[model samples]
Target: MAEKLESIELALFERLIDVGKLLERRADRATREHTGIKYTQYEVLIRLRNAGGEIRMTELANKLVSTPSALTYQVSQLEKAALVERVVAPGDDRGVLARITPAGRQLLREVSQAQNDMIRDAAVAPLDREQVEAAYAALGALQRHLRGEETGGILPDQAPPEDTH
Candidate 1:
């Protein structure tokens, strides 16, 4: 009985990861089709926009769960495309901030409807209201626990403070 229970728990964990990857794959394909940019880049634009169109580089990395080097590469690409710009953080000579450009905002606006439709079809349409709510609650709890209460908040735009250590 213990072995059976363990198997069930393992399956749940695996399925959660699988579903997340599957969704990312689908979103990536759709984002590329609509914007000529990878979903990863698009996500950076989204995060910057959510954070009032600018955020510290370190904080953005934390929000994306990405390495600074990887984000630097992405930001460089976006900068070349004129979709984002790197600016010196106010009052901090050593700190940089990533800000979404008007073009980035326009791109997001242009693709907004398609992205919404794709998400609704792929993630929401199949689930009933009750299932959606239950999943949201469960995932919220899991995200908070995994990300820590200090880092994860009720809204995605609520960024944690930069790590000083």
Candidate 2:
């Protein structure tokens, strides 16, 4: 007798979601313990740093997967903590950009170093270097596919449309 078929799609997606939640929880706890900032705030600061310390609120909110209102609240919290400030965009007084202060950079450096230290102290050995590199390449390709980049028609099950609605 064969085993009865079930919801394989649900199983796969649920497993992936569960793993993501676990990873996020661990990161949040670790970052909060060492940097006094939640993972989301740390991610915001890191993105700002990568953007050369200034980015429009709309762009930041999109990257954060948050709404403008919610992002404003977060920015206000950061501003109150003296870690970030709003500045007028050059040539556009109406446009506001978030700029990390000198103090914010110092804090980001401290927080990043601490996180790196924690990761290193985990004592986990890297997988095969060649395999890891290949995996990264594959992931980049997969990310492109997932992000709606395709040359030919993709199967519905292979690539679901992104929900921007």
Candidate 3:
């Protein structure tokens, strides 16, 4: 009985990872077909726009689950494309911020419908309403735990508290 339960748990975890990768690949392809930018760059632009058009580089990196160097490279590429710009954060001369350009916002606007359609077709269409709700609730719980917020999750827009040490 214990072995059966363990196998079920393992299967669930593996399936979740597999589905996430599969969906990401599909989304990447759809995004690239609709826009010239790669999905990673598109995501950077989207994150910038969602964060009121600008956010500190470190914060952005954390939000992206990416490294600072990786984000710097992406921001540089976006800079060349005129999609995003890096600027000194106000009141913090040492801090850098990533700001979306007008072009970035325009690109997002143009691709919104296509992105939505892709999500609906690839993700939502396969599942019934109840299954969707259950998955959402389960994933939400997992996400909170992973983010170290099972007790009380920090809002995505809020900055994490600074470490005293």
lDDT of 3 by residue, 40-135 (tens): 898897777667778899988987889999999999999999989888987999999888888887898799889889989998999999998887
What tens-digit string does per-residue lDDT give for candidate 1 at 53-78?
Answer: 88899999988999999999999999
- RMSD list, candidates in order: 5.3, 10.2, 6.4
- Worst-scoring 10-residue span by lDDT in model 3: 156-165
Evaluate model 3: give its TM-score. 0.85
Better structure of 1 and 2 per TM-score: 1
- For this target, which candidate reaches the highest lDDT against the unseen true structure? 1
Q: Taking the tens digit of each residue's C-alpha lDDT, what string does model 2 give over 1-165?
A: 977657995696687578568767877888889867777887777667766677899988876678999889878888988888998888998999988777777786576666766544431235566865775566567557765432212222343322221
Off by over 4 Å in 3: 1-5, 149-165
On TM-score, the stronger of 2 and 3 is 3
Candidate 1 displacement at residue 139 in angstroms? 1.0
TM-score of 1: 0.87
Error of 1 at 132 (Å): 1.0
Q: Highest TM-score: give the candidate number.
A: 1
Please tell me which model should have the higher lDDT, number 2 or number 3: 3
Minimal lDDT window, size 10, model 2: 156-165
